[model samples]
Target: MSKYIDKQTELKQAMIALRQERSQIYDELKEQVYHTSEYLRPSSILMRTLKDFNKEPEYKTTVITSVTSIIGGYLSKKFLFGKSSSAIKKILGIGIQVFTAKLIAGKMTHH
Candidate 1:
């Protein structure tokens, strides 16, 4: 056979190999895309979220801290300043201060 004929034969084989490889790559890509779509379905996403929730402490800490803080606030407000005569004296003092401020503002506006 001539050299030109052999070169043409080699080019044809190379082109055929390249086309097969391209088709294989396309099939692999399509398969991967289908698998990815299945992986991201709603049920799959929910399962993934549940898995992550089991692995994290966000919900636990949020519940514990929220209840503790609310109870602590109520208890402190009720117990810190108990119903004693001294507490009554403090409340009366605050009322006097507010009354004096209002009297002063009224006098200023009168001028």
Candidate 2:
């Protein structure tokens, strides 16, 4: 009877060890699924980009400056330019305005 009791105790200890191992394996599989799952992977790129955009202060400003320069150049060429004006002159004008705007913005941001 004492031998049977000892055997029962060993079985119970083994079962507890098995249960703990199972729990750890379950957690590892859950983490693997989260990493390789299709639904999470595609959206993760956008999420990461948005996260980076939110985290980085300079990225948004740089994009805004580029877009603003392109729009400004187009507007200036379309409205401020005369039909008879040379293409080279128009381009130079746009370049000058964009450069000046960037310089002013840089100065403002620095101060």
Can you write out model 2's per-residue Cα lDDT over 4-110, one digit (the tens) per residue?
Answer: 99999999999999999999999999988977785468688788888999899899887776666566556655555545368787787777667656765565456
Off by over 4 Å in 1: 60-111
TM-score of 2: 0.39
Residue-level lDDT tens digits of model 1 in 40-89: 99999999887886788876555555555555544444454444468675
Question: Taking the candidates one at a time, how many backbone clashes does each contain?
Answer: 0, 0
- The number of the candidate with the highest TM-score is 1
lDDT of each: 0.69, 0.75
At residue 45, candidate 1 shows an lDDT of: 95
Task: Kindly report which residue stretches of model 2 are placed more than 4 angstroms away from their true locations once superposed.
Answer: 1-44, 82-111
